[model samples]
Target: MKKLICSLLIALPLTTHASSTLRCDSGLISLQDSTSIVSSKCGEPISREFVGYREVQDEYGFYNEVAVEEWAYGPRNGMFQFLRFEGNRLIKIDSKRGR
Candidate 1:
């Protein structure tokens, strides 16, 4: 039981995780980066998609609808990167190996 617990603890950190930053030819794009910055650094994704609109609340408790978009870049080194944006800020980054 102790060995199993130790092994599980050791393996936990090795699990895949979503990245918050992407390295581009010009610079690194990170979460909360503006769309313009990502575009300038990454030089346009292979595809730009409008996922939908997300409702967000402000500090004042006013609700606003923001555009949600997903951009795909790759197959760089046999992997593809997907970027998700809410309004004009990058919110998430994901990567997957191509088949």
Candidate 2:
């Protein structure tokens, strides 16, 4: 019983990521690609954007009732220096943390 519980605990996190991949129309890509590609496929962003970093390296998107987006950049570039879009609205994205 103790062994089963321990095994499950370890297996749980592993299963979610089972692979170092994020699905995309082109197939699996790095985590960065997962976020960026959405924009191209989905069309112009609705507004949310990231901020902080001095340079914006990548862009992302997601839309439901509201459009949401995130722009990221190389680490050390800044806290975010990226962008976020919330349905035709823009916000400085905090790449360090994303939704």
Model 2 C-alpha lDDT per residue in residues 1-99, reported as the tens digit of each score: 345434334433322212233233344333334344544543333233432233333346533454455543322322222334444334333333211
What's the lDDT for all of these models? 0.81, 0.37
- At residue 56, candidate 2 shows an lDDT of 34
Stretches of candidate 2 off by over 4 Å are: 1-64, 75-80, 95-99
lDDT of 1 by residue, 16-96 (tens): 348989999999999999999999999978777787899999899999999999887776886677789998999999876
Local error of candidate 1 at residue 54 (angstroms)? 0.9
User: Which ranges in model 1 have alpha carbons more than 4 Å from their true place?
Assistant: 1-17
